[model samples]
Target chain A: MAKMHVKMTVNGKAVEALAEPRTLLIHFLREELNLTGPHIGCDTSHCGACTVDLDGKSVKSCTLFVGQANGAEITTIEGIANADGSLHVLQEMFREHHGLQCGFCTPGMIVRARRLLAENPDPTEAEVRFGISGNLCRCTGYQNIVKAILAAAATLNAEKEAAQ
Target chain B: MIPAPFEYHRPASLAEATGLLAELGEDAHVLAGGHSLIPMMKLRLAAPEHLIDLQDIAELKGIARTDGEGGGEIVIGAMTTQHELIASDELARAVPLIREAALQIADPQVRYLGTIGGNVANGDPGNDMPGLMQCLDAAFELDGPNGRRRVAAREFYRSAYVTAREDGEILSRIRIPLPAPGHGFAYEKLKRKIGDYATAAAAVLLTVSGGRCGSASVALTNLADTPVFAADAGAALAGSDLGAAAVDAAVAAALAAIDPAADNRGPVAFKQHVAGVMLRRAIARATERATERAAEQTV
Candidate 1:
């Protein structure tokens, strides 16, 4: 197959690249775009290490081809932090609550959690559990991950209330 | 997981997509969300010579109402992602069972990349939506060189890894008729974990009147060669009160239709048992919801 041209907005930047039709979004990000925060764990969709934010939703990057994302908007974990590297609230909570171990699943975890908190600003422990259930962390058994999500929710809610 | 090399076509319109599919014949695969096809392609389990990427066709996207005057049907484009279905307020109000079923599908990331049309069009038994579609009596529209044809959900699947897809036909849209005002629907599934495929799944949508089930539709997935429509099992509720006896009869009918394989998910006996239990739970929930709708009408 011939290489296909894809134009999409990535990390708030307009990106146009030529890729093989079979090139996965994960590969396009990690190799072509050089955004390495999104890891490739299980090539089979079983592992969520290749998750990324696409058009306001978290999707498995491995499951999609680059041609599929043409004209789409995508956000990798690198984009989660502020311009000067200040952490997103979820990242701060994950660090403060010790939510990650080894961090293979962190990017996907952060990406999935970002949308979870967006949908349900204050989720219960069960909701948090359900929210990140798509992601798998081999090192941590998920106790602290749940706590970190709960803490992030509180922080976000408090910020919202204070703003009001 | 690098997939095998293949020619790609992103047709801008439905007519172009059908033309591409026709030109490529069986060598072509319509790339909806690629949640299923890309994985299998990467595994080298199935490789196609041409990939007719369907995402570019705007006509094959979005959710809208189209039953003559917008009072009878909800038409979901074949490329409507699971995430789209879950977040659709229109679907939530019209057929919450679809939203509920969409909610439980392989978690968020998969749901984001997976489409209901892909789920049913792929015809995988492990998919959570086909049984629900069957229960709802959804209609699948197909467009090819011969123009358009709509296949009933009951007759969609031909096997576990196959459907009634023609040599060059692409599933254009999925049309689900709105349920009766007093109808209720539920999907019951037993998975080992949050994102696992159901060991067995049972879906029920009941239309009852005057304290008795006027009609009911039931379907089971992953327990048969194809998504099975339990006409007799659904008939078990006909003229029967929405009580334990009705659930029991529904369970019996569902089991009678099941022909499950004994695999790692569970043994045949265990799968049957779980199927029965889940069917009852789904039926009971549907009954309650339908009853509430009836009360709301009276109010």
Candidate 2:
């Protein structure tokens, strides 16, 4: 198999790499780009540990090949922080709400939650759970994880209102 | 697991895609949203030598209403995602059953990338769209080296992972004739979890007038090797009042049509029982909506 030239924007940076068409996007992001924020849990697209925002959609990176992601813009958990390197509201809420126990699913959960909040800034409890249904968190039992997302949504909405 | 290495081609147009498919022949596979194919690739169950990604093809990507013989039909580009289907208010208003079934598919992340074309074209019995499409009597448009052709959804599926689609052909679009105005619709799916496939499901569309069923279409999903279009079931409720007896008869007809092999979901008896329950619920809900639609129209 021949390696294909892949070019894409990840975490606001232009990236170009040569990868085999069989190289999964999760491997490309973690290996070629050194962006390991996205974890590969199930590798079968069942676990959302590989979730990332690709072209405004939350997609599992493990299921996508480098060839499929070529020329697409992507955001991983590393891109969720503010420009000054401060914690994102979701990250803060996760800590305050005890959203994680083992933290293995945190990166994917927060990355997915970021997109969920972006799509629906003021999601209800059920909406938050439904929005992040793809991402699994075995340690948290999703009780506090849901709470953290709802809290993050409230905080984000307040910030927007304050700026307005 | 990593997929076997394959050559990738992103075609800018449908012509180029079809050309590549014709050239590559059986060694090539068309990539839609890739939710289905990618997993198969990773599992090594399907190892085509060439992958033709259709994402760049602008032609296969929208929802539009076109004038046709019986009222108008909604033409959906095959690349349209499940998320797009749920987001299209026009589709929701025209063929709400689609949105209803699309929502019951995979979870949010999977739905974001799962294409309607991949769902129906794959001929997976577990997929909800095939039966729903059959209930709506949709047409699948296929393009290949020979020419473009249309296959009715009712006649498309031959078995699991097999369909009316031929080699070097791509399902370009789905054309669903708009249901009669104010027709009742419901897609009842029973699944163990959010992302799991349906154990047994039902799609129902019917119109009620003067407290009697006017026209009805019923289809079941995950009940057989192919999505079963319960023609006898639909016929069973055509003129009845949609009363208990009529629904029971329809359920019986639907149960008779399905040959469900026991799997993780349940044994044959349990599946049949659930299928009957799902059909009964779908018919009742559809009838209620039909009656409500009729009342609203009279107002």
Candidate 3:
């Protein structure tokens, strides 16, 4: 396999990795870069377990080749913490609401949901369901996840208002 | 499931991409978002020796519309992601039907990674874009060693997973004319679950003028080897009253037009039933929206 040189900013840090031509972003992040926060549930793009923020959108990293993402800014679960190392609102919400059990799909779920809430802060229940439809949770019928997201939206909005 | 290895080329320009594709011939595939292709590649269903990545081709990456050119056509770059398509206010207002379809595609993650070009270029009967694209009467601009050419959406798909594209050709843009004022369109898809492939889907576009059906188009997905355009159903509605009786006739014809095959999803009979139900619902929803717009126009 031929090798390729890729340079990009991942999770607020500049990272460079040399990889094969067919190296998927998931494998590059996990094996090459050792950023295993992004899990790989289905490498075939069916499961959003490999979700990560690329450029400004939440995308399935498994579908992306390392070369395809050259120079693009990316965010993963590892970046969701504040400079003080506190969990992000979505992370906090998921934990408080018991949004996950078994936790295999939690990272992708929170990453995807954070972007969703960013775009639509006050989305209805239907919108929330559609927003995170890509991220599946076999455990917990998802009622609690929805509740957590709604709760996070309220907290974020209140915090913004308070700061203003 | 890891995909079979392939040589990857990230061409910066359309000319370069087309030239590389020509050099690689049938063994080459264009990588748009790869939400569709990568999965097939991993399943070992498609093993191209060369992948000409279009992500670097900046020209094919955004949605552009111009209201200044008298009446305008929405020109969506071939590699525009589903996220971009759904985000465009122009698409939402000028042709909300496309956004309606975009909203139901896969999920936020897949939509973020998938491109509209890949959705249509894959030529899968199960894909939601084809039926809607066909109903929009869209056109494709192809660039190759022979220069650029255009193909209408209706003529783009030649067979199962095959298109009219030449070995070296690359789709540059998808162009759709502004739909009629007060036009109402809806896309209805029934899927097994979130992020799962839709079992059966329908895209309906039509305009009701003064209580009469001025024009209508009904297209079905996953009911055939391609997005089947039910001509008789639209023919039965065009220029007629879009009342209960006319809708009934069109629905029946549209259902009869679909020849669904048995798959893991369900039996052919079940698919046919769902197709009819979805078609009916899409038409009804589209009509209801049309009525609301017409009422607004009078105000």
List each model's interface RMSD: 1.2, 0.8, 1.4
Q: What's the lDDT of the predicted structure labeled candidate 3?
A: 0.86
For model 2, the docking class works out as: high
DockQ of each: 0.80, 0.88, 0.75
- State the number of backbone clashes in model 1: 0
lDDT of 1 by residue, B244-299 (tens): 77778778878999899999998999999988888888888888888888888888
Better by TM-score, candidate 3 or 2: 2
Candidate 1 global CA lDDT score = 0.87
Clashing residue pairs for model 2: none
Restricted to chain B, the TM-score per model reads 0.95, 0.99, 0.96
Candidate 3 C-alpha error for residue A141, in Å: 1.6
Off by over 4 Å in 3: B66-71
Task: Put down candidate 1 lDDT per residue, A1-164, tens digits, no spaces.
Answer: 78988899999999998899989899999999899999999888878898898888888898888888888999999988977889998999999999999999999998889988888898989888888878999999999989998998999899999999
Candidate 3 lDDT, tens digit per residue, A48-138? 8999999988988888888888899999998889899999998999899999988888989888888998899998998898788888788
User: In candidate 3, which residue pairs clash?
Assistant: none
Backbone clashes under 3 angstroms, per model? 0, 0, 0
lDDT of candidate 3 over B140-175, digit per residue (tens): 888889999999988888667888877778889999
Score candidate 3 by TM-score against the native: 0.96
Candidate 2 or 1, higher TM-score: 2
